[model samples]
Structures are given as C-alpha cells and as structure tokens.
Target chain A: MYSILDNSLTLRTQLFSIVGSILLLLIIINLIRREYLKEGYSLLWLLMGGLVLIFSLFNELLFSFSNFIGIDYAPAALFLVLIIGLMLISMHFSVAISKHEKRIKELAQENALLKSMLNKKERKRKTSKK
Target chain B: MTKKSVCIIIPAYNEEKSISSVISSIRKISRRYDVIVINDGSDDKTKEVTEQTGTGILNLSFNLGIGGAVQTGLKYALAKDYDIAVQVDADGQHDPRHIPQLIADLDSGTDMVIGSRFINKTNYKASFLRRLGITIFSNLILFTCGKKIFDSTSGYRVFNKKTIAFLVRNYPIDFPEPESIVKLLRNGFVIKETPVEMNRRATGESSVTPLKALYFMASISVAILIESMKKY
Candidate 1:
C-alpha cells in the first residue's frame, strides 16, 4: 500500500511540473511572437521559463540545488527563485518608468512653449496686417 | 544696462475664483513683465478666465503637479530668451506688487531671489503643525547649505537667465520648494531672499493637509540630504 501511494505522488509531481513549465514557455513565446512584449523584456521571461523547464525535466538537479541552498523542500527552492526574478523585473520596470516620466515632462514643457510662440507669431501677423 | 524682459509665471490648478484678479493685478503692475498663466489641467474655468484676461496661457494636457507646472514655465522662459522669470501664486497669496522688489534683488547679480514672508513678518500665520514642518525644513537647509532661508516653503520666487536655464533642465518634481534651494546652493548659484507681504488666500483650500504635511516633511528632508550629497 505504501509503495503504491509513493509512486502516485511522484507521478503527480512530475506531471504538474511538466504542464506548468510548458504553459509558461508557451505563453512567453506567444507574447514575443505577437509583439506584445519587447525583445529586451522578453529575454528575462524566456530565461525564467527555460530555467523552470530545465529544473522540471531534471528533478534530481532541483533536489540537489534545494539541498545546497539548505531548503528542505525542492519546490520551495523554485518559489524562492521565482520571487527573486519577480523582484528584479519590478526593479527594472521602476527604472524604465522614471526615465519615461522625465521624458514626458520635457515633452509637455516643449509643447506648451511651442504653442505660446506660435500664438505670439500669429498675433504679430494679425496686427501687421491691420 | 538695458531692461531685462520679465515673464510672470502663474501656476494655477482649479483656481478660477482668484485667477482673473491675479492676472489683472499683474497687468496693473506694468506691461514690463509679460504674464503667462499655466492652467495646470484645471477642471474649473481657469483657462477660460485667464483667456478673458488676455494673458498667455500654457494649458497643460494633464495634471503634472506644481513642480511640473513651474518647470514648464521655466522651459518657456528659456526658449523665449527672457532674461528673468518670476513665479507668482494664482491663489493671490503672493502680492504681485512685491515682484519689483524681487527683481531689484536679482539686479544685484544674484541668480535667484525668493520673496519671504518670515523675513519681516506681518499677520501671515501658518498653522502650528505646518509652521513646525517649515521650521524644521528651514533649519535642515540652513545646516546643510550654511545659508539661512527664513521661508523655504514660499513658492514666490524669481529666477535669472542662468538659474532659469539650469532649473529648466533639472528641477525637483515633488516637494520642490525647499529642495530647490539646496540644488541651487550645490550648483554654486547665488540666492537672496527679500521681505514680501503675503496675503491670506481669499478663496480655494490649500492642497497640503496634516497628513500631507508629514509626508512633505519626510520627503523634503530626504531630498535635501540626497541633493547635499551630490557633487554638483
């Protein structure tokens, strides 16, 4: 009875890993192919998906890595890596947002200035015509 | 020396009630200074009212906050090649009559001039908590820059061509008033403050609340420290 239960649990874990990793890979590829994600940003997601697939295919490697990191559970190690990856992605996004915000501010200022200058020129032309 | 062209920049947000009066008062002062009202994406009739006054209006596409509005004005000043730019509050707290005094101080070759209410006080009383925050910022700036700025929170200020150019390129976005002084000092720009009578706002509620005041104090302190650490 114990042997059969252990076998079933192992099969379920393997199936879950395979399905989850494939789904992640497919979604990331689809996004890139559709141009919804830029090449630069997609590189990170591709790397993350590739790592998940590698670990899922070689469960022993994941187990060893978890042991090396002193994590008792192998799946917990994957969660740890996922959290770090998300944090890095968020940090990158913050930097990009700051840069874009500065650019937008400069553009708005320029737009306002140009409009004012054009108005001045128009007024001058109207007065001269009169 | 030839007279320097001056542009009065009024950053108004939902200030329809007092904007017309402010523009008229500026016009009454003299035609020497051109008035430009920055309708900072006001939902009210601020743009229409300013238009009726016949002053130039820089209508922002969206709300960029006070710092963005002021920087827009500076950018305009730079592009238009105006020698001086004066910032006046559209809420009518800053008296436009004091503008000539600020300009006079700028004439002494200072890169920037601030119109202060605390230098020679009238009945301009800030709330106790707000005054505490201002005092703390004043001392922080004084300690860091070694220059006493009596009213660091006062937005009423004048910028010469050089200062205006620098600010147009790089100005603090949030809680800019006090931190800007630190930036100017770090860049080796000269700044002077003159006493100006500040009138109580006749209309419109102040944007700063008690909670915002606390946040303002913390953020401004951080900004001042970070700016002081910079080489330039």
Candidate 2:
C-alpha cells in the first residue's frame, strides 16, 4: 500500500509483484486477442490476476496468510503455490492433448485403410466389367 | 440376384476370437461387398485372423480407440469412392444380414442409416451408469445437433456417399456416433435410423465399463459441444 522505492527487502518483493502482475495482465490480453485459450480455462487466469491484485493492494493479510502457512516471505510462498498449481493444471492439459493426438492418429490410419479398400474394389469392378 | 457394393468397416481390438465369425457372416451375405477390419494396435491375433479371412485389413500402429478406428474406415470409403459404407462391430452382437436393409435405405437417397435396437424392442441392457450416460449424452446431442438421436453410441450404421465424403473431410475421432451426426447435420447432411435387431455380444466383454462410461460421456459431451460451437 505504501509508495515504492523503499530500502526494505519487502519493497523489493513488492516491486517484483508489480512486475509479475503486469506480465500476467499482458498475457491475458494477448490470449483474448488471439482466441487461443477458451473462456472456460481463462477463469484460472482471472483468478490469478485477482489474487495478485489482492496481494499488491493489501500486503498485511497476505503476509499473515503466508506466516500461517509457515513461509518466511508471503510473496515467495504465493509464487510457489502458483507454480505448483500451474504444474498440476499443465499436466491435466497435457493428458487431454495426448488423448486428442491419439484420436487424430487413429482417424488418419482409418482413412488410409478406407482408401486401400476402395482401390481394391475399383480393381475388381474393372476386371469383372472387362 | 442383384449385387450391391457395400463396405463394412469393423473396428477391432484384441478381437481374435470373433473376427473370423464376424467376417465370415458378412461374406456369406454380401460376397461382392468389401470388408475392412481396422486392427487398433491389438496385441492379439486379431490382425492374423483378419488377414487369414482374406479381408482388407488396416493395422494401426497403436490403440486408437473405437472412434479412431471407425473414422479410419470412413476415410477409406470416401477415398476409394465406395457406393456406401456400413459400420459393423467386430464383436458378434450386430447382425451382418441387416446390413442390406441399411444399404438399401442409403440407396433410396438416405444420407446415413442407423440400426436402432430400441425401435421395436428394448432388449439391450447395460449397467445403469451406461444407460444414464447414454440418456444424458443423447439429450445433449439433441440440444446441440437439433435432432432426436435414439441411439447416440451405436456403431452399426450405414453411410452414403454424402455422409462418407463429409466424414472423410471432418470426422469426430472421440465419441463419434452421436457427435458425428451433429457434425454431419451441421454441414447440411441428412441421417436416418432403421429398426434392426442386435443380439447379445457373442464374445468378449464390453469396452465401456461403468467408470469408463462416465468418463467417456463427459469427455465426449465436452468435445461435441466445443466442436459444434466452432462450426459457425
């Protein structure tokens, strides 16, 4: 809440928080513009932004929560939690993508089969006609 | 006897036991029609048996699931320019004799024909979870696809040139049956379901266990919803 440029290590942490939040905001903006990520998943990003904004504006409560969690630094603790959560979600997405990739491959192979069958049938039809 | 050219695409996985009977039954009825068995990376003698039957076989390098295997058959039908394509199960439940009725309807200008087990009888039974999953998925398909689908997951169906062409271009590789109908309709293709009886599976257990049934329905529902929404 206080003005930045303080000499305290806490101020340095706050400076990083400001930078990270801005980067996240920019990412959200870019994703929305590109329409790559669906709205269903963007809720997580919105939650992240809300959490960061809360930490940036109200430093005392976040620190107490961090202390409650037994971390010496709340921002660092928050960052760690975010990283773990991201890793889990990323793993989930990787599974989904893997399933989709498998589906695509299956379809491709089936398509190839159909093509070969059609050719054999064509050859038979021609021989019979002649 | 008037001969008709039909292609039966079977998606088989570890189905070595029943592939012989399945292929032979179809051959007995439609000798002129071609059969393509998609070996979905089965680590069994399914590929061997299918090859011995002298039928067309496509070996997938790995297990691609049922949807992937069937889509592969559709792609072949479209590419080879078959008159009509029929999707028959590798398991012995679906009767190959009824295939002619499906193809007949397709010849009568039907874009797609489905063999409905629930039309005159409700003899098909599954786990309660599977039934519920099918119900919910059918409703979702109805909502999104703007059509009432009686059997959303039935693999026994017939496709005309129109349906085959569309599927070759863009086929749903997951939860294909019900969702593929939506894709076809969205692209202005027509679909029809004819009443055809199905016996209990002759061999092997069903791939859709209760837990997997839930996962299958939820994942496929999401895929269908997303894919349909993107159709524009």
Candidate 3:
C-alpha cells in the first residue's frame, strides 16, 4: 500500500529485508560469543539469515523464480515461513538450554567442591610439617 | 567458640509445610550448632519458608536430587571450616534434639557419630520390609567396615573435620552409608553410634514406597559395592 513507484517500493522493501536480516545475524552472533547460543547449532540460522540477505539483494531473479515456482509473493512467503520456523526452533532450543541449566549448576557445585578439597589437602600438608 | 563448631545441614526438597518447624527446632538449639538448609530446587514455598525462619540457605536453581543437595551442604561446611558437620532431614522425621548427642560423641573425639535406632532397642517403627532391608545392608556395612552399624541409612550423623574433608572430596551420591562407613574405617577414622528415637515424618511422604524400597535397596547396595571396589 505504501508503494510510491511501482518498482521503487519493492526496492525499498528489499533493502529493509536485507537490513533486518543483518540485524538478526548480529544478534545471533552476539549470543553465540556470549555462550548463550552454542556453535554448529546456531550456524544454520546464521547461514539462513545470510541467504535471506543475499536473496533480498537480487530482486528480479528471485521474482522470476517465484513466478516459475507458481507461488505469488514467494519472497514474502519464504520470509514468513523462515521467521515462524526460526521462532519454533528458538523455542525448542530454549527448552533444551533450560534443561541443561540444572546440569551446569551441578557441574559448578562439583567444581567448587573439588576446589575446596584441594585447598583442604594443601592445608593438611602444611600443618603436618609442624 | 572452639566447642568443635557443628553445622547442621538439611537438604530440603518440596518440604515447605514442615521446613519452618524444622528450622525452629534447630533454632532452639541454634546456640549449639549453625543450621544450613539447602533448598534443592523445590517448586514450592520451601525457600520462602526457610528464608522466613532466617536459616542459612543455598537455593539451587533446579532439582539435583537429594544426593546433590547433601553434597552442596557438605561443600559449604568444608568451605566455612566447620569442625563438625551434621546431616538432618528437613521433613522433620529426624529430631533436632538428637543433634547434641552426635556432637557429644564428636566431642569425645569420635570422627563420625551415627544416631542408630537399633543401638539400644529394637523399637524402630519402620515397615517390616524396611527393617529387613536396613538389617541386611547394615550387616553388610558391618562386615565391610568391621564395625556393626545398626542404622546405615540414618541422615542424623556428625562428621569431624577430617571426615568432612574426605566426604567433600568423594561423597557417594547414592547409597552413601554402607560405603561411607567402610570408607571412614579404611581411612583409619573413628566411627561411633548413638541411640536416638525418631518421629514419623511431620509432613510429606517417604520417598521410599514398597516398589521404590526394592529399587532403593538394590541400587544402593550395588552402589556401595562399586564404591568399595574403587581405590580411595
């Protein structure tokens, strides 16, 4: 509805799509480095974002292919599907992460216990010399 | 303050209704021992109740079972340099008043003091099967450690610094007693027993159902045997 020029708004929408994809990519990257997102698993979304960004940059070719595939607004449909799929996958991964948080806590407590034991042994050795 | 400082560690799981009275009972004896309650990821008001009682609490964000909860408590005692450590239940099955007797044994230089129900009398009100299971395992613990342990599964016990240090390093996550007794004896640490009458749980059901009791006995027996085979 906001299309000013016939093809001009399509160009603007493609630019917006590319920018949004890049922003998502940046967020995913930040999450990866922060250890909130593990690697190999997150690589799929990163690549998908990149693919969407690339698809947005080439407009005429994608439209021609969409016409060939007999799907109206293939780019928009693909974008919607990808967003919904990613949301579901993100939800699934969050559940997995939530499940592992307990294990991580147990590991942390075990680590603390190991450190405590080591310090006590060191103390014992020092005291034994006296 | 060198009265062989004892810290009673209670590993709580979903015992909000009973934990306050547990805390209060301990508080009555708080002048003798510091109470530390490990609220092990209860999906209830366990933490809130513990906090209301102003007991020292370590709130685990998720459930790590009773074994992990108790180990966390042991780690805390080891870190804080507590001279003696006691494990008590938050469900109020074990009386807090019996804590002094364990400490008294510890004061007499017993490295570990276990409150045994069968030590003086056989009036323990456990189910027949439970009594049988305890008898079999306690006998095995006696054979392995060369010391008769009338109650191998009692949580009410005291450990001195040496035993605490050893336990913090290697706590049996399951079937802790039979293995622990043997471990203490093998390490040349003194172990003693005291008689304490226990009450039926004030709230909550025992985790050991008849079916679970069978599983518990088998699993813990295996765990103890495996632990015995492990070198140190």
Candidate 4:
C-alpha cells in the first residue's frame, strides 16, 4: 500500500492525476448535457475516466497489480492497459463505420432510385399531354 | 404462355461517349425490349444522350458505385414487374448481342446467367493482373462455394424476377459482382454461365488500376468469404 504521504506518490503527482481525470469527466458530462455527445457513445469514455480516477486515488494499486501479474515495470502495465483500451475503442469505431457505410449506401441508392422515378413520371406526363 | 418482359440495365459512370452506341445496338436487336440507363452520377452528358435516344433513364443523384447503381436498376425492375433484367456496362464492353442468349437461359430455368469471357476461349485479351485476379477469385469461389464460376468478375448478367427481388435487398455496395454470386448460390438460387465475347473499351480506362486492384481483390475476397460462411 502506498499513499501521497509515502515517497512513491508525491502530493503534486496525486493532485495532477486526480485533476486530469476529473476534468475529463466534467468535459464529457458537459458534452452530453449539451447534446454534443450521445449517451450511447459516452459509456466507454466514462469508463475510461472512472478507471483513471481510481488509479489516481489509489496510487499504489497499479504498481501492486503489475507486480501481481509479474510485470517487471509498473509503467509498462499502464502502457499495456492504454494500448488495449485504444485498440478496443478503434475496433468499436470500425464497427460503427461499417454500419454507417451500409446505411449511407442504402440511402444514396434510394435517393437515386427516387429521383429517376420522378424523372420518368414527369416525362410520361409530358408525352401524354402531346 | 405470356410473352416475357425484359429491361436492359446499363450502369454508366461518366461514360457518355459509348453509351449512345450501346443503347442503339440493343435497340437494333429489338425495340420491344426496354433499356434503362442508370447514369451513376456521371459528370457528363449521359442522361441527356440517353434521353435523346428515347430510352428509359434513371439518373442517380450521386455516384453510389456500381453495386448501388445495379441494385437501383433491380429495384426498378421489380417495381415495374419486368420478368427479366439484364445488366450491361455502358462502356461498350459487354456485347448486347449475347443478351438474348442470357435471357433465354434465365427463361429456361436458371435464376441468373453470367456472360463469361473466359468460358470458351474467346478473343478477349485480358491483362496478366486481370487474369490473375480472375483465376484466384474463381478458385476461391469454387473452394468456398463448391461451384465453379469461370468469370466471377463479369458484370454482364441476366437476372430473373425472383433473383432481382433478392438482389435489390442483398446486393453488396462495393465490388459486388463476385460477392453476389456466392450470396445468391448460398441462398439456393440457380446460377449458370455461357460464353460471350467482350469488345474492347470504346472510351475511358479500366476501373481497376494496379493500386486499386489490390483493394478490389481484398475487399471482394473478404466479402465473398463472409457471404459463403453466413448461415441463412
């Protein structure tokens, strides 16, 4: 167990991490409140903020978890978690993009079909009048 | 028996130069068969020329790629209750002469008939890279689908009413030709191929360049694999 009073975590370092995580959460909440961010997509970001908050509050937890996992470097464990989180987020984005591509294609096709149908009907009307 | 109705769907993208000739050739075959040119957001005079020729025209608002264009045509065919829909390129590559043969096959029983360029050693001279893609795609299709498609990439095809109905719902958006074959076959649609000669492009360049060829291969191959593995 380590604390800010201990040499491992300085009070300034603790304050920085805690402030960073809180700031991230505040920005996210503000975006959601303003309808700039959908609640559906905010879950992952909120999860990230909460994880950072916990890691900052319990400064020794990351080191201890890394040690338990036989990781020689505590910072490497942080890097690993960050890389995995980013990979998951990127994967989520890819799936969303694929869905949007399918939807956009359908919409475009429908638009084309409708425009052409209208053109045909207009032409038929002109021919009938003649 | 009632006479069958047919619509020739030509998906054109900036292919105004050859489109007129293509439509006239089909008209020469038989004026009774309706022709509709799907001007796929062409920045040219394709729509005006097609209209001037007194043929049907579906001018897309924007380019939806070839797949979306063809699917739109199929949807229109379904709506108009056409008995058969034949897809022909507007670049004058697909000889409309073989269209009757393709429709005949569809009329006989086959849900779809592909006009294959490599089936009977035709005079079609494909580039080495093009031939490689065809061979790999054909083999991959055979291995995954358990049926041989000699010209899996051929866009010249005729679809019966039922097939058109299915395709309007399930056509892939990008590089859809090869993928659609596996999809239809997996869903219990009968597909056959007949030898048909292809003319050299009368205008524009090949859509598949060296760089795009890689993208074409990867995307269509993955799409085909997915189609083959899908259950129901």
Candidate 5:
C-alpha cells in the first residue's frame, strides 16, 4: 500500500515534476498560438503535460502505478513513458517528411511541363506573326 | 478503323551534344509521329538544342530522375489523346530506326513492346559486371512472374494508350525500367520484345557507376519483389 508520506518522492522531485510539466504546457501552447506547431501535434504534447501534472499532484498514485508495472522506481516509469512518446513522435515526423518530398517532386514536374507548353505556344505565336 | 497517332517521348538530361542529332534522326524516320523532349533540369544547352529542332519540349523545373521525367511525358501524351507512346533515350544510344518495329508490334494488339538488344544476340555489349547484373534481374523477374525478359534494363519501350494511361497514374520514380516490367506483368498487360541495335552513348557519362550499379541491383530487386506482391 502506498501512502502520501511514503517518502518515495522527495520535495525536490515534486517541484521538478510540477515545474517541468508547466514549462512544457506553456511551450506547447505558445507553439500552437504562433502556428509553429499544428493542433494535431499540440494535442500529443498537451496530453504529455497533463500526464506529468497528474503524476506530480498525486505522488502516491504514480508510485502505486509504477509498482504495478514492475518498476522499482516511480520516476523511471515517467521517463520511460516520455522516451516512448518521443520515439512515436519522431516516427510520425519521418512519415510526414517522406510524403512532402513526394509532393514536392510532383509539383516540380508539373511546373516544368507547364513552362514548356507556354514556351511552345509563344513560339507558335511569333512564327504566325512573322 | 481510324488511324492511331503516335507520340515519341525523349527523356534527356544534359545531352546537349547529342539531342539535336537524335531529333534529326527521328525526323528522318517520319513526320507523322509527334516528338516531345523532356528536359530533366539540364544544366546545359539541352533545352536550346531541342528547341532548335522545332520539336515539342517539356522543360522540368528540377531534375526528377529518369522515371519522373518519363512519367511527365506520359502524362502529356495521355492529355493529348495520343494512341501510342514511345520512349527513346536522349543520348544517341537508342536508335530511332527500330521505332517502326516497335509500332508494328503494337499494331498486333500488344499492350507494350520492348526494343531489346539481347533478344536474338548481344549486339550492344556492356561491362561484364553490368551484363551479370542484367542477367540476374532477368532471371529473378522470370522466376517471380513466369515471364522471360532478356533485356530488363532497356528503356526503349512502346506503350499503347491503355498502357500510357496506366503508367501516367502509377509509375516508379527510381530505377524504373526493370521494376516497371514486373509491374506491367503483374497487371496482366501483354508485353512483347523486338530485336533492336543500340549504339554507344554519343557523349556524357552514364549515371550508373560500378558502385551505383551494385546499389541499383539491390534496390531494383527489392522493388520488383514489392511490385509483384501488390494487387492489381
């Protein structure tokens, strides 16, 4: 049974978790507000911030959950979650980059084809005038 | 039946030295066929050379590789309602003289026809390693599709309107020659090959070097496998 005063989390750990979660939430909100990050991506960051906030407020809940997951240390479990989330975000970015690259190639090809057609038409006009 | 119009697609990249000669050779063959040159972001006088020939030219804003360039030409052909589309290299290697043979084969209801150098004999010779790579690709394609293709890497090909429409919608972007054959076979398109003589390149270096050839073989093999597993 985990108690609030189980001494599993120190005051410094609690302060760090609260401060870090607040900072992440602020950064994510600002990014979305500035249109630097899309809403779809901001949702993921917001969820992470919420999780951090919840774990920090209820230290007992985090400790119990870490024990349930066979983790000896509660903070390690939080770090593990963060690592997995980062890996997923990075993978998503890679897929998005591949799609954009394909689109850019298609656009470039279309631009070239249209330019050539315009040149041909201009030449035809000049020839007819001559 | 009405007469079918043919469009000759030449995908050239920095082939200023040979583009004019190639255009002239095609012009000598016949005036009935419409010629379109796809300048794949040539950093030279390729566009001007093609323009001087008074042929239709499509200048790409950037280099999209050979497959992308060829597909762009196919898109143009499809848009213009061309009945037949022929692919000829910008370099003088692909002789326009054999284009008639490709068209004649297409007349027999063939969906796609390939101008192969190794059909009857090895008229055009490559390095031993290159030949080995081509042979491996041929056998691999044969094993997977149950179709024997002697010159799987030859870009000299003819496609009917149906094939052009299909390619315009779906075509690979890299090392597309061998892989496209597998795709065409999987889609149940009838393909035939005719003997054609290929010349050595008039100028400029080939994109494929020895190291790149190895990489090309590996990637092409994977592409063929993936293409075969795709549903039509």
Candidate 6:
C-alpha cells in the first residue's frame, strides 16, 4: 500500500538503477579478483548484474514485460522479480550450508573419536606403567 | 558361530544423573562387551562419571543432538571394527539385560534388531499423543519400505558391522530412528523387531514439546518419502 511508485519510470530512478547495476557488477568482479568471492558464485552475481543492466537500459521493455506478466504496477513487477531472485539466492546458500553441515558433523565425529582414542591410550599406559 | 566383539553405544546428552547407573548395569550384564558413551557436550559431569566407571567416552565439543551423538558412536564402532554395535539410552530407558537378546537376533541372520515394546504385551506405557506419533511413523515406514515394523521409533537397537558401516556414512541428523529404518530397509538390510519391555526414563522428562513433536512427525514423513523415491 505504501508503494507510491507510479507506472512511469522516473528518470532519477532509472539513472540510479543503471548505476546500481553497473556498480554491483563491478563489485562482484572485484570481489572475485580479491578472492573474497569464488568464481563459482561470481557467475551468478554477474548474470544478475546483466539482467539488471538490461532492464535499466530499456524502460520500454520493462513496461512491456510488466504488462505481459499482468502486473499493472510496473515497479511492482521489478520488485517481484527482485524478490524471487533473492529467494533463489537464499535457497542456493541453504543447499550449500546443508552440504557443509554434513561435513562439519563428520569432522566433529572424527575429532571426538581421535580424542577418545587418545584418552584410552593415556589411561592404559598410566595403569600399565604403575 | 564365532564370538563377536560388541560395542554398547550409549549416546548421552546431559544424562549425568542416570549415565553412571546405565554404565554399571551394562557392565554388570557382561564384561566382554565394550561400552562407549558419546557425551553430547553435557555441562554436567557425564564425561567424568563415565571415566570413573572406566568405560570409554567421547566428549563432543557441543551438543550434536541424539542422532549426531549416536552417529559418533557408530563411527567409533566402525573405527574399532566391532562385530556388533548396540545402542542403549543413557537415560536408563533401555534395559541393558536385553543387549544379549538383540545381539542374538542380529546373529540369527538379520542386519538390525529393534527392541520393540509393541510386539508383545508389556507393562510399558506411553502418552496417547506419543502413541499416535508412533503409529503414524510406523505406518509411514511401512508405506515407504513395504514392510510392517511395529516400533519404528524405538532406539533400543543392535546393528551388525555392515549396518554400522553404512550408518556411519549416512545416518540422518535429526530424529534418526524412524528414517534409519526406512533407509536400511530400502537398501536391502533386514530389520527384525522383537518384543521387549522398557523402563520409564529414570531422570529428566522427555525433551519433546508439542511443536517439536509436530515438526518431528512432518520431517520424518518427508524423509521417509524421499528415501523411498531414491533408485538405489
């Protein structure tokens, strides 16, 4: 209800979207170069950046896209797509986390096993030496 | 039959009050059987108490829930190369006296033996809600695995070395008892259920709340379905 964004893409917002998309793409590339982001993830960010760049470049297409999708509110259509994109990214992270969680569990189990074996050996050695 | 080396895996989480008694009772049952307690990061003296009894113990850095603790014990069993591994609750719910019978069942040509309370009439009792959950899970397991198991939720179980090796690699992390049955059954492992009486827990109340129970039901149902859908 608080969405005051009109169907017309304000030039100021259009400029911001273009700048933001370009900036996001640059940051993602820089992150990959700095080893902060892996190549595996940089591709996803770059694709998102390309999509945002395409939309920012063509407001006419954005309007048509929203109209085609039955979203009367053009900005709402963009928001919806952005929300879905966020959801997908979150889900990808969740899948990655699940994989790592299993590994962490195995590591913890192995750690306990080794520590217990050491504990057993130390006790046995102490008793036998006495 | 050759004499089999057995490991009694008791996954204890803050079970300090009853762990000592549980260990002693198992030791009383047989000295030949090795006992290992996976101390699930209890702030209590569970590790110390277990050490005093001279039984082996794995002190996890944090609570890994019941499934993780049990899997740790399985890993230990696999590493130690025990012929059979029987899991007993550290809360004193499972009687150690039945270990031999479970091992016997395992030896009699089954990969797994579950100490079921429903196979025969026993003085053991459970709440109506809990029983409803048990019924639902057992049926879910049956539907997924094409076999009727009376007590899918019973943790009092004995696993042969092969099963232990499998579970060490694939045991579920949350509420594993029911899903493990489905996984085992689907993978062509035989699970035999025998009637046995279980003592009411001697110390703390069950950790299950109503909401957790609901989640447990839903998660396990989905897990069973997914397990059944796998091709191999």
Q: Number of the top candidate by DockQ?
A: 6
Global fold similarity of model 6 (TM-score): 0.93
Off by over 4 Å in 3: A1-130
lDDT of 6 at B230: 73
Q: In model 1, which regions exceed 4 Å deviation?
A: A1-9, A123-130, B230-232
TM-score of chain A of each: 0.87, 0.71, 0.55, 0.86, 0.86, 0.83
lDDT for model 4, please: 0.86
What CA root-mean-square deviation does each model show from the true structure?
Answer: 3.2, 8.5, 12.9, 2.8, 3.4, 2.9
| Chain B superposition TM-score per model | 0.96, 0.91, 0.93, 0.96, 0.96, 0.96
Model 1 lDDT per residue over B1-232, tens place: 7988999999999999999999888888898899888988899999898898888899888888899999998887887899999999999999999988899989656999999988886778888877898788889888899999989989999999999999987899987898799999878899899998888897967777889888878888888888889875
Q: Considering DockQ, which of the candidate structures 2 and 4 is the better prediction for this target? A: 4
Tens digits of per-residue lDDT for model 4 on B50-117?
Answer: 88998878877788889989998998899899999999999999988898888887756689999999
Global lDDT scores for all candidate models: 0.87, 0.78, 0.78, 0.86, 0.88, 0.87
Pairs that clash in candidate 5: none
DockQ of 3: 0.07
Tell me which of candidates 2 and 3 scores higher on DockQ.
Answer: 2
Docking class of 5: medium
Ranking by TM-score: 6, 4, 1, 5, 2, 3
Candidate 6 residue runs with Cα over 4 Å from true position: A1-7, A123-130
TM-score versus the correct structure, for each prediction: 0.92, 0.70, 0.64, 0.92, 0.87, 0.93
Q: What is the lDDT, from 0 to 100, of the residue A92 in candidate 3?
A: 72
Fnat, model by model in order, equals 0.61, 0.39, 0.09, 0.96, 0.91, 0.78
Q: Model 2 segments beyond 4 Å from truth?
A: A1-130, B1-4
iRMS, candidate 6, in Å: value is 0.6
lDDT of 2 by residue, A1-130 (tens): 3323222347677778778887887898689779987876677776777677667766776766667777765556677767876876687689878878966785568565655567679989999999
How high a TM-score does candidate 3 get? 0.64
